[model samples]
Target: MSFTVYNFTNNDDVKILHQMGQFQVLQWDRDLSLAPWTAQQAWFASQMDVRRRQLIANLDGRTGVTLQAGAMQWTAGQIQATTGVKGAGDLLGKMVRGAVSQDSMIKPEYTGVGMLVCEPTWQHLLLVDVAQWGGSIVLNDGLFLACDSTLQHALERRSNLSSAVAGNEGLFNLRLNGQGTLVLESPCPQTEVLYIDLQNDEVKIDGNYALAWTAGLQFSVERSGKSLIGSAMGGEGLVNVYRGTGRIMMAPMQAATSYNTLASQPTS
Candidate 1:
């Protein structure tokens, strides 16, 4: 089995497939009188953004969701769409693994840009480079980082720069200042993740829903007391608080399992 990649510039001549088991690309790019690109070339070009705009599963209608690693070989029974935006990746019929996939290779430049977006209930492992981009995680209940060998060595030696920051929000966020990838599992995924940046300001959330934010941001948890009782019965729950200037990613209130169930069904 073999694969060939071709661009739609139409510069290459159209090659005919003579043999049976041979696979070749037939690129058609020039248009007799169209805008610029041929219809097929334009269509293919439009689909190029699929790489950049990668999103989580949409649990609404039919979808074409990309899966992380380990989850590559699941049946349709194991997956579903995860967005309100129709026609995004919704695991439908049979399941084929591909979302760049977990354990996929990483380039050095994506730092502070790569995001791991999964459904609330998904239990699959995600592969991310801890040194370069690190892992930007958010969970309502708990979060952990499984660093790669390179990162682990630095962590064990206490020689890591970001790890030596003492007991602060930076410690809680677990920055992989060294090199390696982290595999994280999150609990309570269906919650809203709001990344907020105040003007040297602050923000608060309930429970432990805060995920990773910028290192410059200060970290701590505080309580809202009954002395402010008027709103105590308002179901506001204790707000997991933060201050300073940076971003905060928060998860939603629903559990991952329930959200997954809802996602697998079709809309009425």
Candidate 2:
């Protein structure tokens, strides 16, 4: 019942970017100590604009947190983990959803009054309020990190088949519904993200730069120009289009780049 974390919050090297409800996103301002050779690598990483960030999940005994499988790094106090499975049928359903959505099949849930920390990564951690998205939101692939267990999860399919095949996005997306906080692993920093609010309007993008959007929005893929000749002349082909009224979170930069790939490489 009694616990303390020393040199965690007090450490000058760590910067707290966001904290809400039961989650906190922190970033290490710099790696202070390193060998000469590794220090050179760190300097190059700095020049390349890389970041070291982590997510902290704080359970309050009454509420539990659901995380992507294999995301937990460490935990303290009276914490317990469960598969969040109800029955054989539920497991099968989750498996199907996971297959189409490209998300972890069985998300692990943690309960009890404790602090759970996720593995550190260079990817930016974003804390989103589901309520801000009108109690529901659909996320692009691979963005889901963690969420309050109170939220409901479902698969949201594309508006049309062409949208799935031509847009470069898959057929189904993971949708979360309810009033809770959701954590996302973003390829771009929050500062670089563009937030768009639409009112019976539409927006088009040449690539999959959208991170998340309101679940009610109608999404599809379409030509950038009215005709094939125009599209070819404009040098633009299919584009992702969102219609209706909702909010969108878009990153101006491409999601796949050297910065995101660096996480897969071993680090000293």
- Which of the numbered candidates is closest to the native, going by highest TM-score? 2
How far is each candidate from the true structure, as Cα RMSD in Å?
17.2, 1.9
lDDT of 1 by residue, 197-262 (tens): 666887766454554454455555443544446436656634445666666655455432233442
Off by over 4 Å in 2: 47-49, 256-259
Give candidate 1's TM-score: 0.35
Tens digits of per-residue lDDT for model 2 on 145-260? 99999998898888887746865668888999998999988878878999999999999988778999999999888888999899889998888889999999998886522345
lDDT of 1 at 112: 17
Candidate 1 clash figure, as a count: 24
Q: Evaluated with lDDT, which candidate comes out highest?
A: 2
